[model samples]
Target: MKTGTNNKFWKYAKIITFLLTAFVVILSGCVDEEQNETESGNTTNNSQEITGTTNNQGTTGGDYIYGTAKVKSIQIVTLESFPVQVQVIAKGYLPDGCTKIDEIKNEGEGNAFNITISTKRPKGAFCTQVITNFTETIPLEVRGLKAGNYTVNVNGVNGSFELPVDNVPEETPGSMSTKQQIITEADNGTSISIENESTFYLKLKENPTTGYSWELNLSQGLNNISGEYCPPEQPEGIKQPLVGAEGVHLWEIKAVSKGNQQVMGIYKRPWEKVTGKEENFILNVEIV
Candidate 1:
């Protein structure tokens, strides 16, 4: 009877041990599945965060390329007033919708106004591939400039404007005098007499873009005070003058002594040898 009881106890213990082992295995599988699911969710969220950061950096950060805009033309507008007010209108097209005007810089050096127009776009970004037209009107600082022809370059597109008279106000000292005379192309070969120490002006037509300018030859008793070139004036209802148009060269001269003074001008390029076939202007002056 004791041996039977011992066998029955062993059987029941084995059955309980097997049942415990199966239950532990099932519990371990469920825990492992839950852990894997949490890890997968974390990986997906991290991927989204990384992608968002990259896009934000591309748009608002310093990840961009610099370029120049394609300028088609430029219009120089002059206001009719003393100390001329001038503005330049730049017309161009952007290569893509993503491209934008980054900066515009202008500085006057001698007779040229250099304008730099820069553009920027996001790096490695997809954008609309359509061309966008843009117009920028920029005012020029012409308060201290002398009367003459001035050239403007906007992104390599060239245009010119003229200051017909000195940009200074008429009330400025020595700006106007009663002893001054005006000379024009129509006055060529004409004899004129003026008082000693008197001043005179000569306005001659010239086209520097063709490499031709008026070379002046002044005789004794005459002194050249100053000179400047002025581009052609824009007509009424006209936006701008054509590129490479003819302009005027204004020369101020003073009669120093009383004698016969002859003025001669030859239109030719300075680098070329003087040929008699070139155009010439002759003037005779008598200073008393």
Candidate 2:
């Protein structure tokens, strides 16, 4: 009975040891499986992140790949008391490969500039706002211009358009019309018949310091000719053969007779010592 009990005790101890060893082996295998799952999950997440980053870079880089862009159109809105709008279509393209990135309201010193006009005033006025990487619409006010034709220039590019303004009279307050008159009389001294009366004036310039005097001779056809005559003289009444004014002096002559007669008048500005006649500087008059 003592030997049997001892044998039973040893058999139970061996069975217990076997069970414990089996539990340890199973636990180690489970731990290794868990570690492998965690490492695999981390590798999958890292690969996904790299793919996403590469896709975003490709989309952004493709935008400027071709290196060509165009300005589609330009519009102007006039913001005067009355709103007037104008549209312009651009025929040419802009710099190549310019992709629109962003835009905003602009307020800076170097951005503003002045436009000069050779005429009275500009046909249109406006404030220009700029945009980056994209086409933009501008605004303008039309004023102080005629309702005919006009042009607008941006940088060096030019465009033609029309303006809507009242047609004001071309004559201004200070503007003066030139006056011109021409009178010719026949040789008949008894009765003077006016031949031509045109209001057109000619240029007359003379220098009287060199003993130059204009002579008026009456035609022999008329008699009893008389009128007030003003010979060319200096404002200070300085005699010829001396320095005088450099302008033609005006004179008036008239004649009357009982019978029909012819008269002639000649204006002579002769050299002082020389006997030959000097050239006559004609006068022009304009009629109103």
Q: Lowest-scoring 10 consecutive residues by lDDT in candidate 1?
A: 172-181
Expressed as tens digits, the lDDT of each residue in 29-127 for candidate 1 is 999999999999999999999999988876775588899999998888774434567889899999998999999999899999999999998788699
The positional error of residue 236 in candidate 1, measured at the CA in angstroms, is 15
**Residue 183 lDDT in model 2?**
27
Model 1's alpha-carbon lDDT is 0.87
- Assess candidate 2 and give its lDDT: 0.39
* Estimated TM-score for each candidate: 0.41, 0.23
Q: In model 1, which regions exceed 4 Å deviation?
A: 1-60, 170-288
- For model 2, how big is the CA root-mean-square deviation? 24.2
Estimate the Cα RMSD of every predicted model relative to the unseen true structure.
15.2, 24.2
